[model samples]
Target: MSDLAITLLAGGVGGAKAAEGLAASVYADSTHIIGNIADDDEFHGLWVSPDIDTLIYSLGDQIDRQQGWGRKNESHQVLNELEKLGQETWMTLGDLDLATHIFRTELRKQGVRPSHIVHRLAKRHGITMPILLPTDDVIQTRVKTNLGALSFQEYFVRERCQPTVNAVEYEGASIAKATSESLSQIEKSDVILLAPSNPIVSIGAILAVPGIKDAIEKSNAYVIAVSPLIGGKTIKGPADKMLTSMGKTNDSKGVYECYAGLLNGFVIDDQDSMDATWLETQGVDVLVTPTLMSSTAEKAQLLSKVIEFALAHRNVRAA
Candidate 1:
């Protein structure tokens, strides 16, 4: 189990939580995370990568557990000052959190690859696990709403996801080149797990990158996704709503449809067992378990089951 090289495709709070579980598991040292980059945006002239930072903070045990993001015991003096200067402050940037953005922005301007910058940041924070970015090239999530198209930050933070989403698009994805490091991780991994993240904006954004989906399709590793929706509703975020708006059922079935051909198996809560037969008919194995991870214990419990499932499949594949 310690020798197993597991790569996770993840984003958002749920993704961070899953990463934390795996990081604390016995396979922690061999685990790698490929986080979404499309949620990135410029804030007050500094590059702010919310999803990536969340992963880092969660892994480092520096995350504000209550809010599930930003630094714990953080002060928002920077945002308060910006607000006083008549700058929009919808996106809260704490003083400590500002340091990360400043450092990342500086390195990015110095022409460092985003993946390299992430490695440096992780190292500085004492995080030993590999954090891979799907692409260094700029790819932003755009939400098309009845009012107008808005950047992911605007739709998620400024507008508070209140606007009716007509559609979603990954700007620059077609032209964006997938990071070699991430592609190699996928190819070399023993197992690939899709974190219980927003299927549309988080995991979907990573897949939208040109070579990423192809790499996953080509990988010999078994791919499994834990459903973010439990009982057709998201514990946090707009995943359920987005899936519904996108003409998909807001349940485990919708999640399976989103991942479709890429998944070898799907993990769903016992409550969503109604979709198990349908999914199995589509040639995807179903694992029914308690998917909620509100506590660290629960997280480890779920991850242990996932690891066991992966190991069983790997042995069969090897045979």
Candidate 2:
């Protein structure tokens, strides 16, 4: 349906994968993405939005396929120079990737809205679909670990997620102003999907923005979430460890509980059929399929099923 509108709440590599899948699917032109900016940090005096850039690079066909982030054919000349200058180069920014951070920082200094900057960046990358930001206001993810509170980048990229996560705080999210574009998209969408990103940090950071969750709850769109876990473990990242540390069940069912009443359906991998059954018993529509996105074809395959499930549910609701 060309007229159908879809909105995605996404962050991190999993989010990028889901965005890519939708970009490759029939809904490419109609899909709108709201990405997490909680992982954003300033490095070398330049602002960097890791999750948002990953989504843009992935959708624009410029993402490094191997790492699931950053641009392909990238060179780290800038990072090397910074290293020689005795600057902390722990957060690696490639020569080309540095340009994105530069432009974004400049825009921010000029008082440009974060949402407009994302739209501009997406257009520059040849991405036609809208990449909306959850909020134009500044919000960051602070991880309270055994080593003390660390910025999301420090805990993730610098420390390699080795520290125990005691808690996660979305600094400024409660006071952040939700972007009108994002809210409008949620209101008009026929379907909204929470990509298989880390429920605690990635998707959690997005939902922490006050108006976002409320908008999703109030919207008529059929909301669905894909579990990031397969066999009670994440293929990549510290979602499982964080979940356990935060006293949540380390499985797909826990992932569902994170969103609770916001979801109309939940999608889990075939390995997590137990969770599927549990979710169904709770009166939630469940879709069990192979959710590991190893390639574009696989991503599209999974998304196609999710779309089918959404359509089916809509029909049932209508009946």
Candidate 1 TM-score, C-alpha based = 0.97
What does the lDDT come to for candidate 2?
A: 0.90
User: Counting only residues 3 or more apart in sequence or on different chains, how many pairs clash (N, Cα, C under 3 Å) in candidate 2?
Assistant: 0
Clashing pairs in 1: none
- Residue pairs in candidate 2 whose N, alpha carbon or C atoms collide under 3 angstroms: none
Model 1: C-alpha RMSD to truth?
1.1
What TM-score goes with each of the models? 0.97, 0.98
Q: Residue-wise lDDT of candidate 2 within 105-186, one digit each (tens)?
A: 9999999988889989999999998899999888999999999999999998999999998899999988999888989999
Model 1: residue 120 alpha-carbon error in angstroms: 1.2
Error of 2 at 160 (Å): 1.0
Worst-scoring 10-residue span by lDDT in model 2: 274-283
Predicted candidate 1 versus true structure: per-residue lDDT over 174-270, tens digit per residue: 8999888999999988889999999999999999999889988898888999999889998888999888888999999888889888998889999
